[model samples]
Target: MRRPPMISLFTGAMGLDLGFERVGFELRLTLDINKFVCETIRANRPDIPIICNDIRRVSTDDILRKAGLGVGGPVVITGGPPCQAYSTAGKRRSVNDTRPSRGGDLVFEFLRVIREAKPQFFVFENVTGLLSAAIRHISFYERMRKKEHEIPPDARLGTAFEKILEEFISTGYRVKWSVLNAADYGVPQARKRLFIVGSRDGVDIPFPPPPTHGRPDSLDVIMGRKKPWLTLKDAIWDLRNRRDLEYLPFPSWGKYLKYVPPGGSWVDIPRELQREAMGGAFYSQGGRRGFYRRLSWDKPSPTLVTSPTMKATCLCHPDQDRPLSVEEYARIQCFPDDWKFVGTTQEKYKMIGEAVPPPLAFAVAKCIMKAVKEDPGNPYSDPHLKFNF
Candidate 1:
């Protein structure tokens, strides 16, 4: 069967598109605002048509023309819009974020194209924080007040997600969404993301795609059906001795990292030096596990951030004193060894960090293809399925 053409938005590094392509989906056009990301895409897949303009300025007509498609075309649309506004790691401003540079409202641009192009299928991806985001952000201090209950429903938890879903539903698509961990899908990271899959024809896509890998002691692994989760050692051990590896130097506070054991963090620092290492963060209540954190050979990595040198989200190498190298980042994200990334080292890191891991994307594409091919007479029928893990 000829697979439907795919038009990708926010196509950073083409990690997601690569996975779709591996599953036989032909990518027709890719779009993104970042110049470096566009260069990377071109450097790797020069044949693909790419739009480097911001999505807000790029009309649906332009997208359709570039993809060589018409209204209601049998095409699949996929994108992970700018997610910082909904990311827990950042200020959860939701739709209230108006910074043009940040593009917090770009999710609506995605919705606009979906409505205009009327693609047969669409996949929306974002950080897991989207599930709990409020349309109007309530600061932690405000929430601590005795009158917090007086806050309007629109300002309460999950309102932002509800509003997003309403917008998608209004476009006449049957949507099914779930939170999935990339490790469960065989990616060597414990990243969890939200995926919303929709069908214009009301065909329900079977979701929470079955796990291909599990914890070493999990039932599925014990039963000999699923493989054990891929580990940091499995992903980047070969690159350890490479002399040409590129990585950022640690910040001054990272001097304390030497005392941190593999898989440990600031908590492992000597009691006398812990306060000096963490500074004000030492008084912070949360686990603060990312501080001076070192990857463990036996475990999957923590989610890759834009930079490994940040004080709060360090991605230090297990045995080495330095951060994970650029090559190691690509490996953990399942980018092929030959994949060419454009721009400076930091640009490459940002692109790789923001990408959906290819292995996880491949798993999703496989399930989506299965749904597209199967008879729709008896669909999965569940309108919403949330995975527990």
Candidate 2:
């Protein structure tokens, strides 16, 4: 059977596109705002049409024209917008910041294009924080001074998710979303992301299958139902022996990383050393587990950030006393060893960190392919099929 064609937006580094391609999806056109990312995509896949401009400047008409598709086509749209607005690790700005339009905000841009292109299926990927991000109105700030802190019923948690789902449902799509762990789906990292899958034909694609791997002592692994999660050693141990691979210098915090054994973090520092290593953060209340953290050869890596060497979310090597290298970052994200990324060290890290892990995307692509192949007319067989997010 012929695979579906896809029009990709926010196609950073083409990590998501690569996974879909692996499952036989044909990518028609790719769009992204970052010049460097676009360059990387072009360098790798020269034949694919690319639109390297702000998504706001491009119209649905432009996307269709470039993709050589009409209003109705077997196209699957996929992308993760700038996630800081919905990331719990960040300030959780929600809709407070301005974008192209209230309608053109990147999340809504995904919807707008879907409405205009009217594709048969669309997949939305984002940080899990979208599940609870409140959609605070501008007036909520002014009212904050007069009232005690509390979420208004209408503006409570999960409002952002509800609003997104409602828009898709109203536009004649059946949708379901799930939080997936990359480690479970064969990636050698513990990153978790939110995936929303929709079909204009109301064919409910079940959430990707149960995890295939986990911790050795985890119930499934011990019970013989699944394999243990991939370890950091599994992903990058070969690089440790290679003399040709370039590595980043040990961070200024290297001295502290040397003291953090595998599977350990800031808490392992002596009380006096903690003050010297973490400064004011040593006294902070919460367990800042990411601080001075070193990867364990026996476990999957932590979710990567754009910068691995930062003091807050230090991804120190297990025994090397340095940050993971750019090549290691690409490997963890499942990019081929030879896939070239074009940019400065930090820029390269940004591209790698922002990507959807290829194997995780592959699992999702496989699920969608199965549903499409079965041609389940009403895939949402359950009445309670909508995600409760």
Question: Highest TM-score among the candidates is held by which one?
Answer: 1
lDDT of 2 by residue, 188-280 (tens): 999999988888877767665567788888898999888888888999998886556555665566687767788899888776788889888
Cα miss at 89, model 2 (Å)?
A: 1.8
Q: How much lDDT does each candidate structure score?
A: 0.87, 0.80
Backbone collision tally, model 1? 0
Top lDDT prediction, candidate number: 1
Model 1 per-residue lDDT tens digits across residues 64-162: 998888887645899999788888885678888867655568889899999999987898899988888899988866866737578878789888999
State the local distance difference test value for candidate 2.
0.80
Q: Report the alpha-carbon TM-score of model 1 versus the true structure.
A: 0.94
TM-score of each: 0.94, 0.89
RMSD of each: 4.1, 5.0
**Poorest 10 consecutive residues by lDDT, candidate 1:** 378-387
Show where candidate 2 strays beyond 4 Å. Answer: 99-104, 137-149, 152-155, 247-251, 376-389
Alpha carbon RMSD to native, model 1: 4.1
